[model samples]
Target chain A: MKIVVCAKYVPDATGDRKFNADNTVDRVGVDGVLSELDEYAVEEALQIRDATDGEVVVVTVGPEVARAAVLKSLQMGADSGVHVLDEAIHGSDSAATSLILARAVERQRPDLVLCGMASTDGGMSVVPAMLAERLGLPQVTFASEVVVEDTTVRIRRDGDAATEVIEATTPLILSVTDQCNEPRYPSFKGIMAAKKKPVETLTLGDLGIAADQVGLDAAWTRVDGFTERLPKSAGTVVTDDNGSGADQLVSFLVSQKFV
Target chain B: MSEILVLVDHADGSVRKTTAELLTFARRLGTPSAVFIGAGIESARDALRQYGAERVYVVDSPDVGDYLVAPKAEALAQLVQRTGPAAVLLPSNAEGKEIAGRLAIKTASGLITDAVDVTPADGGVAATQSVFAGSYTVNSAVTHGTPIVTIKPNSTTPEAVEGSAVEERVDVTISELAKTARVVERKPREATGRPELTEAAIVVSGGRGTGGNFEPVEQFADTLGAAVGASRAAVDSGWYPHAYQIGQTGKTVSPQLYVATGISGAIQHRAGMQTSKTIVAINKDEEAPIFELVDFGVVGDLHTVLPAATAQVQARKG
Candidate 1:
């Protein structure tokens, strides 16, 4: 079995996101981390590889900076890595990103493709479905559990209100939700072995894709500008002078139409 | 001129409120048509008619509803090919978003999701998105294939218009690759008396300041017929279900009216609801960041304030 997990490197979600004078994110001094959600997808792929004794490959489409994302996946136990880097791939929206990923997946022809339900930075859970459309493949989003038996894979999904069991064949796309599983930390042995893994770096020209197919030019959406929120004026402070919490609260409530 | 298509979101053919909302937005760009994929058109027709759908394309195919979003998207893509629609509109829920994303790539069209507003541009549709946790409002236009837009609910009040509801049988042949995955079984959610969070017009949310007691917040939500939401802190504490969390890590809700009680308005929390039309916050701490974005604010203990407000709203309803 050949399993592929898509990875993206982004600013650490926990870090403070600062803005530059031009309104773009200030990445000069911020620490970068593996896209938190993608880690779960990589873990799921690694577990599947472990079960099936197959090769696990990680792919990412971004700048040289994105190399870290693919390397991180390798450190987590992936057997191979592919980085599709080019200036043309920059500024692509979710749609364009899916197009590029679909093309790359088509070339690799993996039996299974796994992705995080949504990227933490974009928060737009559109890639899996978009890739499914581009590849003409069936996909299930927000998968909580996956079980492969014979030719078919069974999945249990924890939806908003209920749990459902789903069955799909290999070569299917599964976008794992955050609740799927707790990702494992990279062990010392695994980290050591990752350095020996094959990491192939490819450019857009090598893929035979047009420059106009992605980036801001092909993007369906454009962000005009970002305006910082206005600071809040001081709120009215109702002093609890009497020290009776209930009475003071009632007085304030009545004043605000809570009564 | 090809008609614009809308995927009618319904249960038992009864068109959902968001379907009307999408149709209202659809009319701004082109001729509006409704694509009803599953069964129950008989029950859904009245609502679809009232929502200005000139044509209701019905796909009575069995496999269409048996699986997940794949078949529905294939059907929509098929319809798009034949009818040559200029654009497609879908509600921005999980299912709709997935289907829309697939359909856009299948048609090689420009797709935009989570749009808060839409209006006609020179020759196409202009859509707006509140991104980066509502810190930025983006105005965009699709420059590629038929523009596909998935709009958030409650972005605009749905307006009904009289239209001849014409039904057409849409032919959809499933692709071999489309069957890569199939849903083996489905179990409906146990009915909760409360409304769905995404569909609710009003949402009342609690946060860390709730002190692990959600009674007051829940009571206020129930009184106002609003969905109950929680902050990650509240959900992490098991004060509420993870599904009710509204934050970067949780659900994104843009209700007409959002009431935040005892929430400090963390950036993560604000990312989920800052676009809401009207915000109201109640917290004893004047320093709570939630007050920064709210149109109305009250500084007080929710334990004493909520019961009285619930009574007042209940009395008004009476």
Candidate 2:
């Protein structure tokens, strides 16, 4: 089996993930980490590769920091990596990002493609679906458990209203949830092996995508304006030493018309 | 007025409240049309009329609902072509967003998800989105093609407005690729009799402080007619089901009122619910970060404070 896992480099969710002056995520100023969610996708792909004795390649579409994401996946057991970096790719929305990934994935010609359910920063969770649409591939997303038997893939999707067991043939797109598997830490030997893994870094010119086709100017959606939310004012806090705390809470709820 | 098409969210033909919310929001932009897929049109017609769906476009084809979201996207794309609608609205659920994403790409339209508000602006519809876990509010509009927006629940108070309720049957040709992922089995979640977590106006959440007991939280939630949620700590510790977990990787809910019990208000937990209009926390630690964001906080054990509050509410209602 030939598998390709999509990886993303996102701002550390724990820190102050601020936006640039242009309203895009400040990928340069902040500490970047391989998105916590993508680790699950990489681990799933690696497991599948191990079971089938096939190759796993990690793909990323971002700026320079995205290269690190690919490296992290390689360290986790991806056989090789592909990084699509271009200056014009900055400020691209999920739609454009999907287009770039589709182009990159088409180049690899893999039998299976995997992605995280959603990125930590944007949290749109739409890219995998968009990419599947562009590629005309069947997509089984939000998989809590994925089983591969021969060329058939079955996934358990834990939705809000129901739990669905979805089945699809290989050459389809699959996105996994955090509960799918516990990702492994990179051993010292694996880290050294990743350094020797082949990584092909390409630009838009190499992929036949024009600069005008992407970037902020070609975006279908525009952020007209934005505002930072004001810090919540300090709230009232009362001790329960007298056991009147519940009454005070009731009174507050009444005032807010919530009771 | 041009049509603002809304994909009706439903189960077994019973329309969900989010569909009414979408219709009410659509009225602000243009004519509201309900795109109903699969069975149960008779059961849903009144609700559609009550919420002001001027035209109810029915796609009764089993092909759309039998498969995953791709076929639904195909069906909507055909409707967009036929109606030349000004915009489209869908519930911001997993399936809805996927359909919207595919539709946007198919029709070359702009897509926005998790919009808190949508109103007419600059000759088109502009959506207000609470981003970065509600720390920032941004207003955006589709600059290219028709605006396809997925809205969150409880963003606006749905009002009843009777409409023409004309019905139109739509026929769509589903592609072979859209039929590849087949749902082999489906098990509906057991009913809790509480409101859906994301759609609930009020949510009561428990955390590590519950000590593996959710009785107080459930009792309080039932008393208030609110939904029950849980922090990751509670879910990870096997105190609560993972479906009820509310955090960065879990569900994001913006309710009118949110009550956190025994939660320390970690950033992950806050990201799931910080947009709530009013917040209240019950924790033993007065210094818990949850207190900083709450409108009112009680420094006490939830075991004691919640049961007392539940009884007090029942007495007041009586």
Candidate 3:
């Protein structure tokens, strides 16, 4: 059995996430790293493969720097990596991303496909569902816990109103949340092993995709404009020096009609 | 009139407040047409009518009610083809986002999720998104087919307005592929008699300062009839269940009032509630980083501040 892990390199959430001249995220100026959330998906994939004695292949599609995403997964115990880098892939929306990812995942036929619940940058949390629709497979997303037995896969989804247990078979897409498992750090030996592992690079042409079908020019959504939110005013601050802190807060709430 | 399709979000034949919020917001673009895809239209009709629903399309299909979101997406795809609405509006929950995602592909439309506001633009509906932990405000629009947008709850006040709410029953042929994944079991959270966090007007949250005790936080929330929430730190430390965790991965709440007790206000936690109309914090540390952004602050221990404040509020009410 083979499992494919879909990973992404996102702008660091701690940095000042800014927009470029073209309204795209400023990935160049800000430090980029493998999305912290995707680490759980990579870990879950590795565990499933270790249990089943299969190969774990990591796939990513983005700018050239996105190869780091694949490399990070490789260092964490993946067998190989595939980076889909192309100049035409910039500013792709979730729809375009699902298209590219669906093609890249199709290039590597696997029993299971896994992805993080959402990227910290885009944070749309819609790509996995769209990819499932594009790939014509069942998708069990937002899995807090996953257990696999033979060909059956079950996941516990913690939603807003309820916690549901969903079941599906192989040949499907699964997205794991941060609660799934703890992501392991790459040991020195694992890093050395990852250096020798095969890392293949592909372009839009290699995946049978047209340049006109991607990038900002072909995106379905357009950014009209943006503005920096004005800094909020610091209305009041009261210390507990006189034991009147709670009373002050209640008075403020009363003035605001919250009491 | 250009029609805007609003998908009803319901549970066990009861409509959720998010649906009312969605319908109220959808009216800004065009005439609001609700798409009810389960067995609860009868119970939801009055609320829908009260919220200015000009037309209500119903599909009480078992295949859709029993399965995950894919079947509903398929059913919506057929509806979009038949009605050709100006835009599709759905609640920005997990299920609603997934449905809009698949429906975007099936209808060849642009998908925007977690939009805080939507309005009519020149070519299409413009969505206002709060990005980068509420640092930037972005205005976006769909450039492709029908615009599909998922709106976050508490985006706007749900105002009651009379409407025809003329009902229409439609049949959608759901494909077998959509029903592949099955919901084997459901364990709904036990009733707390509190408002849902995301849709609440007021929310009081606690963090590491609680030291595994949420009684004070719950008591304060109960006094004000507000919802209860916990920071990711509290949940990860086993102080609270994951269901009530509020952070970047957990629920993002934009309520009218947000009070953080004992939380140091990490960037992740700030992202979840930064857009709140009024922010207040109570912490022992004066420089807890949460103070810089809050509208009001009290420098003291949460255990002492919250209970005292709760009592004062109760006294004021009496």
Which candidate number would show the highest lDDT if scored against the true structure? 2
Winner on TM-score (2 vs 3): 3
Winner on TM-score between 1 and 3 is 3
| Candidate 2: stretches off by over 4 Å | none
The residue ranges of model 3 lying beyond 4 angstroms of the native Cα positions read none
Best by TM-score: 3
Per-residue lDDT of model 2, residues A1-259, tens digit only? 9999999999888887788778788887888999999999999999999999999999998898778999999999999999999999998988999999999998889889999989988888899899999999999999999999999999999887889999999898999998899899999989999999999998998888999999888899998778999999989998886669999999999998877
Evaluated at residue B72, the lDDT of candidate 3 is 95
Q: Write the per-residue lDDT of candidate 3 for residues A190-252, one digit (tens) a residue.
A: 899999999899999999999999999999999978999998887687897555998899989
Task: Flag the better candidate by lDDT, 1 or 3.
Answer: 3
- In model 1, the runs with Cα more than 4 Å from the true position are A12-31, A158-163, A185-197, A220-259, B208-213, B236-239, B282-288, B295-318
Worst 10 residues of 1 chain B by lDDT: B308-317
The better-scoring model by lDDT among 1 and 2 is 2
TM-score for each candidate, following the candidate numbering: 0.88, 0.98, 0.98
Ranking by lDDT: 2, 3, 1
- Best-to-worst order by TM-score is 3, 2, 1
Model 2 lDDT, residue A178, Cα:
84
Q: Which candidate wins on DockQ?
A: 3
Backbone clash pairs for candidate 1 read B13-B44
Worst 10 residues of 3 chain A by lDDT: A234-243
